[model samples]
Target: MAAGAPRIFVSHLSGVAVFDPAGDQVGRVRDLVVMLRVAQRPPRLLGLVVELATRRRIFLPMTRVTAIQSGQVITTGVLNVRRFEQRPTERLVFGELLDRRVVLTETGEEVTVLDLSVHQLPARREWEIDRVFVRKGRKGSAFRRAKGEALTVEWTAVSGFSLEEQGQGAENLLATFEQLRPADLANVLHHLSPKRRAEVAAALDDDRLADVLEELPEDDQIEILGKLKEERAADVLEAMDPDDAADLLGELPTDEQERLLSLMQPGDAADMRRLMSYEDRTAGGLMTTEPIVLRPDATVADALARVRNPDLSPALAAQVYVCRPPDETPTGKYLGTVHFQRLLREPPPSLVSSIVDSDLQPLDPDADLPAIAGFFATYDMVAAPVVDEAGSLLGAVTVDDVLDHMLPEDWRETEFHLAEEEVATDGS
Candidate 1:
């Protein structure tokens, strides 16, 4: 099915043809298998199995199902017959997740996903979908459980879901960490408690979790690191900005730090070691190692071409460093950075120097947190360049990271101020 394909309910499913993206008819729905337990809820379809003329059964797990169209169901990307053989059995969430607190998207607000309530339907008591509720207020004063509220999204409203979708329950209105933008991920992380933070991290894959870790504040990053398993901790730390990795390691006890670094890949560990060489407060310390350094002679065209590659990391900053090529004796050969938005505004054939901002103010590697914050305030820069004593471009520190350090309180104040400003601006 196309992304905007029409959806049909499982109760309405009947003999729908299933096709892979390549238009090969892989299977047809046999019957809607609902798993009603002796006491527990019936399992959502374990999945649909297509019976072929050759008497072979091909199974497509509900998770891989992309969409339900007018007459056809679509599976994502491609189909592998062996996939059915290796299909994961329905997850038995008996231990931890069932009745566990989860982020519930109800009433268009994220409230806690609490346990189900057995509410007798008005007309009959036998038939009932799980009733969801929200716990409101502090205990004693006005603490109350608000019931009969659930996010009843039409199946058609789901644009896409990530791997963690099944874990949150197919029927629950939840989104995967990968599906959220970085800013939204940051906001979600900021709002969650430490334990909840750990649970969310556990739910995400290494790469997506790594991306979220990269954007978080150092303190939250350290706290989140403490809660993760050693293997998971090492994976996220290895993928993070070297400066952040070093800061996180410095916050940990020496023994644990060494253990994590040892588990990391040699190259990542070495880069982290180099970053840790600088004091945490300085320019060298704050700079990210993944700057997109380009040659002075590099044209806007060349940089544009480079940016077109899909493989670029999602954590890339809005600024592209215009520098002497990496082959030069020293990287700080004193060029400048071009804001990515500005670069995109011009034709590819334009010269980089034409768009480069020469008056670029930079920070020394040894600067303290306050100093960096002041730099952010002074220049009103979203990202400030980091440089060595030789004025060579190192990496850059985004304003978000600096704000994370400066504002240690529960970020409510900042959020309030931003909301007020938005209201004022909109009125104007």
Candidate 2:
């Protein structure tokens, strides 16, 4: 290590708050951008990906960074607010490099790159990767003790492996991405090339892939779905919220849609088909078929158990529908809903029907977008149940789905501008 080098491990810097010279927070460090040069040379630090309060990401060149220390990064108070777009030569440290496999040059041993150490070069304004902390092991033996601790080796002692050399496609890359939130992972996937995106998608499990797909743009969604085998694609669709699945399917060619739909489970397929039948802007189209539901005779305990499921969306988990037998959608008569707040207030053994909000009117399946939006605003509800003419419990439209529909058709392409400013000329 260089003397007084101000070295910091990349892992510790990942989410550190970024502040202006006056001490106001600008954003948090989401990722570090670097440019690779020679194979044996340390990659040059380019900038930081800062995610602002509005969830918009922008770039802050390292030149604008004044200090990096415990819990925070201090900036020179000058920043370009244009959304961060990765250039062809840039690599994201957290997304692309961390958790990857690298071979030790001396021992011919494979190890996982747990973290990286970056340091400021002596008497220079430049910072570069100085060392790598690697966990010794092959794929399955990752937990084995490495003489009681992992190795902190100089960067030159290891040869970094690319996704292609791993033989399992991009499976190793997926591990790094998995640590990111679904929205962040979606952002990374969106920036990757089509072939690389497909490879990463292939490595993700159905549930994780479904979450990422829900955050992606419709075109990206369609492209990724097309890359998946029909059966696996159907499985992923099945794993997604029904309304989201329907919306993605609606964007695809009819034949492709039907082919994947046929591969799904009969119940899920039926639900998706029913959702697809309605106008894209209507209540029926925006509703998810899998909202938490319970029989009228079920107890609060049952409802609570269903809400506890980690897979359920927050809106869906916030309440439970109380329906009469047969208890399945379309056949079950629409009754009422029990909010989580009310459910928690009542005794666990009490019947769900006792707390049901029967006075709340459900939206008709054909209700227009404006009508649905009005209902939410009027009731201050996170979700509203949709019913057919016979008052059958069909599904529930979540607030998020309605907002997505209300946004402009090209909303996904809009830059997350922080302020009106020209693009910076530096850091290409």
Candidate lDDT scores, in order, read 0.57, 0.81
For model 2, the superposed segments whose C-alpha errors exceed 4 Å read 1-169, 415-428
Write the residue-wise lDDT of candidate 1 on 28-125 in tens digits.
Answer: 76543222222233233334555554556555544456566567778763332422232122232222223333333333333333332221123221
In model 2, residue pairs whose N, Cα or C atoms come closer than 3 Å (at least 3 residues apart or on different chains), thus clashing, are none
Off by over 4 Å in 1: 1-200, 214-229, 305-316, 327-332, 341-346, 351-355, 369-371, 409-428
lDDT of 1 at 307: 60
Each model's RMSD to truth, in Å?
15.5, 16.8
User: Residue-wise lDDT of candidate 2 within 1-428, one digit each (tens)?
Assistant: 22365789999988889999899998999999876544466766777899999888988867568688767999977665646767544689999998788889998988888899898777545678889998875543458534424889988898863233234346446644545878778877887899999988876656678999998888889899999878778878987888899999888898998898878878889999999999988999899987877888899999998887556779889899988776667747878989999988999999998889999999999999999999999999999999889978888999999898899875654522211122332323
Give model 1's TM-score versus the native structure.
0.50
Candidate achieving the largest lDDT: 2
